[model samples]
Target: MTTLSDLLSDPLPSGLGLSDRQWLVLSALPGMGARRLARLACECPVWPDGWLSRLPEQAASALRLWLDHPQRSPFGALFDGLDAWLTADPRNTLLHPDHPAWPALLAQLPDPPGVLWASGDLTALSLPTLAIVGSRRPSREGLHQAHRFGRELAERGWCVVSGLALGVDGAAQEAALNTRGRSIAVLGCGVDVIYPPRHATLYRRLLDEGGLLLSEHPPGTRARPAFFPRRNRIVTGVSLGVLVVEAAEKSGSLVSARLAIEQNRELFALPGSLNNPQARGCLNLIREGAVLTTCVDDILDELGHWAETPGTRSAAPAVPGSDDDDPMLGWLSDVPTPLDALVTLTGQDVTACQLQLLELELEGLATQAAGGWIRLPR
Candidate 1:
């Protein structure tokens, strides 16, 4: 059987050579911005055909001229290292414009990535997908909505797409994974490097569960504020639509929603309390004509006939850690208790208790009350 690992290990055909991969890597450089690269690739004849190979003679002069006068040799050096790094990763496969597996939906975008670096189930890219994105600093309500919608959508056979950030993005991905459904994590950084370091476990689990981790950037690319908006475009471009769970006025999630609108994909917004600051972006989206969604059914209904079609539902399994083994819920009390008191009551150690509390809150098993602690929902 061809496992996802096997697929990832396989190399591209020999015809896909060093220069092509180098070009793709160069095209993905951090400050190299997509529009500028597109312009360069079009205008510089040397760039298209073994361009980097001919660099010493033709392109190097122009590149040096651009670099020296601008006093920006760092970007040029970064590009050189990118080429060397690309050569080292045997698992690295660059999906070109002609690859059959490239999602047709993405091709329609005005600025599609020149290449995609993928790990695990590349085939999943062809599946019908929906992007669920929201605030990195989401409220409790926002987190709940994201998980609920993610789980329900995964149960219905839609592959959840998310940026893998903390809060809403992490919640949605966790929900989909818990349901045994496939999800895709589009990173602002490289696939090999897990950002937010806390998500390292989730990142590894995603690989094992036949999900995918993708980036246009080469391995070793660090996460930066600027990389996110570019990453958002891919999230929106790849999906059938985008759902905004909760977002502040300045949140990156709105960027994905806007891209979805530009892509002409369906857009859904979860309405939140008007006073909650995190709800501001979603409200703005609704006012701008995005569909107001209260439940998963709202989204499925908007998908129209396709929602009812066979083989379109997600393949997620039953939620893990749902049984007695789940340490988080095991420690919760039906009545509110102070954090210090709860720690003594559970006798499970402080850090474990704190993590358990956070997990329980995420799973909707507990709610924060007045003072310092929480109580389980009756």
Candidate 2:
């Protein structure tokens, strides 16, 4: 197997093919945005002649100049910087619409990135993913829920997608990585530039542990206030769903939740205590029709039909009993047994009872409905 050092010594890496190089240049052209590039990508327009007619005047001029005079185009410096960034690390990859490992779900975005800069294993892109986003300054319970959801989702073969920011995003991703599962961090800045600075260790661990870092921006671009809201689209774009563990009334994660809804991806919100300020956004989302999620099974049940992996649909991290043996189902019925009542009857603590209920829900044997948990018709 080729090692990291071996990749570093190689002159030409795998992602810089002739077509990719052209796409990269187009991505840098003036007036070219994701929607336009996506259109052009589908046509695979011929160089110079075909492209010159379709591009905006400014972008056309730049392309013409580059075609005529390769040495002096304004993009030369930018291209050089990109090339240097790519060559500096063998793991760094450029993904375009044509890249084999590119996430097909991104094609559904209203404005998919024209090109993606990525580091670490690209294989993570192929896995069924869920975006776990919420408040950057969460309460302890918010962090705990993020950790729990992240760990369980990863354990269930779902790639946890997040922005790699602090608080909720960090907690979820770290949990996924710590559990030896897969994750992908979509960033507002360059894939190579670690933002938040505090997440430097998480950044390195993500790459080291076979996770992925992705950005639409070129390497070396600094994080900007505007870029993050735009970045939220990509985070939700590639996922089967988005889960807001916690958020204030006006938070970036809410933006992600909206994007998920627009993208037709399932939206989940972790309900928190009414007293917690950070829980307001989630509560609002729940009121707005986002599923009120308590456990990983809630997400799995909604997304199971979208499951691509062989066993992901039915297999979970294993609760105490098998499907038929789960005692929670005994106490639940179509009448919606309130959560406290189930806890009393099962003799298991609240957390354990919730887990079993979630497991039964995952198996389609029970569900949480109006008033409380209920057993489904077998």
Candidate 3:
């Protein structure tokens, strides 16, 4: 495994004209957000000259003004101890915009990260990718749909990208891994600290299964509410498209879909029941002209030639005994049936019956009305 020390020891490119240490220093500077840094690069005449060792008096004054400002100073303090922490880990790599491995997709965004700390296969960033995002508390049917979509996409060749949160995100990554496909997780916090904590094992498994863990924040930054909306843009920015499995009318996943639209990337929404609050956002998105995705083909067809690659094609035989094969599923018919009555007539385990019912409902085979399951009208 290439260590951070090894990456730092490598000679800087002549075009960058900045030492590894100098790059780190620039990243640590106060008020040096992505936009500010880009402006500084443009305004400075002999760029990257004494900018590192000794700032020009005018630049130094500008830096002082930023440091004295209340808002920018505190955020800069977040990186106060990052340099030493990064130096301690051989595996931690901080990649700047000029770095060869920096993701080219991110550069096209208006506000790309100044630095990215990454682990696992950095080359995966160069591969064609898609982002799958949805509600953290998705229904069981939603999870199944996400997994199915993710697994199919992975088997076909596209790298499944997600936030690694619970529910749909977790299902997507797990499905991609199961199919021996590459996946990338873009974190809201540092890569070293798993935000949900419960997903520590999943995080470890990702490293070996052709998956990469990435973050713009340096190591040691804890997950925070404010960081996620900013983090979401990269999820959309890095991918060729974004797939939303299920989302509430005002869910965070909608933010990702909106960002994908703003980036002019394909936005695919899995159609869900209008009755399901979790599905309302997707229905709304479809109403707004986002592609209504019934299956993986809906997405692949939209990608057109890009998806013609062998990896993006699906050939797996459909599994037997899915919802369509369930005999009890036919009992509900077009009219809603009381839960207790259906349980009595079906004579199946309550949990198993409920699971099937949920799947049927999501597939548009059944509907919930007046506290009962009903078959959709013909």
lDDT of 2 by residue, 118-140 (tens): 99988787566899998889998
lDDT of each: 0.68, 0.78, 0.70
Angstrom error of the Cα, residue 276, model 3: value is 0.8
What residue runs in model 3 are displaced by over 4 Å at the alpha carbon?
A: 1-19, 42-45, 49-91, 310-378
Highest-TM-score candidate: 2
Best by lDDT: 2
lDDT of 3 by residue, 1-378 (tens): 111222222222112444444455555576566655544543332544445435546545544544466355433454555666667755556776555555545544556666777767765665567899998999989999999988988877878899889889989989988988888888999888887887887798787766888887777789998989988898887787899999999999999998988766789998887679999999999999899999888886776534454333343212234554666665654444444334335544333456677787787777666425567754
Better of 1 and 3 by TM-score: 3
TM-score, predicted candidate 1 vs. hidden true structure = 0.65
What order do you get sorting by lDDT, best first? 2, 3, 1
Candidate 1: clashing pairs of residues: 156-313, 156-314, 157-313, 157-314, 179-317, 180-316, 180-317, 181-316
Query: Which lDDT tens digits does candidate 1 get at residues 282-320?
Result: 999999999999998898677653354235424221233
Candidates in descending TM-score order = 2, 3, 1
TM-scores of all candidate predictions against the true structure: 0.65, 0.76, 0.69
lDDT-better candidate, 1 vs 2: 2
Per-residue error (Å), model 2, residue 100: 0.5
Q: Is 2 or 3 the stronger prediction by TM-score?
A: 2
